[model samples]
Target: MQSQILPSRAALVDRIALQFEYGQNLIVLLGTSGLGKSYLLETFITDKYNDFNKAFVQVGAQMTDVQLMTQLLEQSFNAPLIDHNLSLSQNYYQLAKQQQCGACLWVIDGGRHLSEELIAELELLSKSAPNVLYIMIASQSKLPFKEVVNIHLEPLNLVESKQLMGWYFT
Candidate 1:
């Protein structure tokens, strides 16, 4: 993701921006619930990216691999997965490599809930597609993948929360 330093948006966002500046393909935002993982991801995307090809998927508990790709197809490519003829892997890869397709970004919330199939496919996509970037907001603290740049967001303390509220109401 291309970026430029701008207005104040917390140190966390700035850190992630630096990671993007390093040209990493996959970045995982790790934080517990209520730590605003989703907020950070959305804010980062909003502040930095201006591209039209971006996929935003919220991973549900029961989501299947097909469901995952279906959302990606719908959001980024505007190509719904109606045909049962092709596998999810083939469909996304074909669309992603299309001559008309621009650089794509995938922002997945609750990424820890993703199934193994989804994870495997994502790794494959990252390897094959040079124009795609993925940001996964997960609550786990582990950095299992050596290729994934992990950014951990700490929860706000009580006083910090009060300070934030003050900033909000001012």
Candidate 2:
């Protein structure tokens, strides 16, 4: 299937792009389960990847803070491991500074399962890498950080619903 979001959703995409361009680093995608939240975020990333280095990781319920940071570092910077002595915020800053790659977009899907400590680390990472856009997909607004840019996705309307069905049936 084509990784395209509906034109009706263009406003949301535009808003995200505008805010990210204007220095909004942490973006939270909130919606009820099965509301196409992941689809929307994926389409946005696919559409915008040409402009930024992109990485994505789906967090599991049992993942530890160190594992989360390791995954992020590997996915975003292709690094094997983060320096244990450095704080998460420091690692993020060091990675951003060392990587010659342009701005990065890090998508953490299934964020609802992350522990409070991991989320807090994410907040610190955002501050350290101002140019890196961190988007978290969660079922609710439970992020520890208050300065996040929240995007609430609504379910598809009738017209869009019919179109999606047609795409599958035709």
Candidate 3:
């Protein structure tokens, strides 16, 4: 398969891989529109951790905290097994306690659309959960939580832009 990791993004990809390798569980990828935040998330997961059980969820504009959490939990685990009676946090806590899920990675896209409250909650869960890594691709840089690995992406420079274009047109 052709590589999704572009020439300009190689360094960023390497840095992220290093961070994840060294036990960086909670990562927030912050970048402006058109900077390939979502693309980077997908590439990083697929290229680096394809063996992991993944829940790729897009956060919609009107989605509530409960909706977001349920979607992640349901996708990560089979919905039929999850206890709908329990609150979302309780359900998440229960799953973490099970310790049966090995190497689960959640890639949450469209994070800028969600409220900061929801983002903070997700960060907390990611920090607390074992064997689960959360990478949120967002334009927003300000996070309620302090202990997070924030990887910011920048637009490619003119030379690098030409190199990226060369990969497509050559």
Candidate 4:
């Protein structure tokens, strides 16, 4: 796992770990493309945490809010359904409520692709739910959601970059 660490991400990961350890519920990791934000997120969740019901959503440029919600619901519930009548936002909200009995962590990657409306819907869902931790990755800092803790991931420093190369390539 050390090999997987990148210099640009070590300090951010340390900060995130500290926040998580302190029970900070929502964190938004902001970075540009190809900066290893997603990789760092994966490493954090896989290596540092357990007992969290995890849902990972990959946002596509062509995806609709409904489609995104449907995908999120499917991942969270491990269910397959073909209900065109039910709006995806409604379904997602309901599912979040149901999942809130336990600790639930949702990782939304490429969130910049989501429409403002869908982002707002997600924000509402997270805000209304008591035990939901939403971690979003985006290229920039602007998010349609509110009350989110933003962590900006800048490019790695020289030492950190070398460390990351060593961790991932060794």
Error of 4 at 160 (Å): 1.9
In model 4, the worst 10-residue window by lDDT is 132-141
Per-residue lDDT of candidate 4, residues 1-170 (tens digit)? 43456544666677876875565656777777777778876776576556766677777788777777666666656454535566654665555555543565677788778777766666666656555555445545567567767887777678877765775587
By lDDT rank, best first, the candidates go 2, 3, 1, 4
Q: Output candidate 4 Cα RMSD.
A: 3.3
TM-scores for all candidates: the values are 0.78, 0.84, 0.82, 0.76
> TM-score of predicted model 2?
0.84
Candidate 3: 10-residue stretch with minimal lDDT: 134-143
Question: Candidates' lDDT values, in order?
Answer: 0.67, 0.71, 0.71, 0.65
Higher-TM-score candidate among 1 and 2? 2
- TM-score attained by model 4: 0.76
Clashing pairs in 3: none
Candidate 4 steric clashes: 6
Query: What is residue 163's positional error in candidate 1, in angstroms?
Result: 2.1
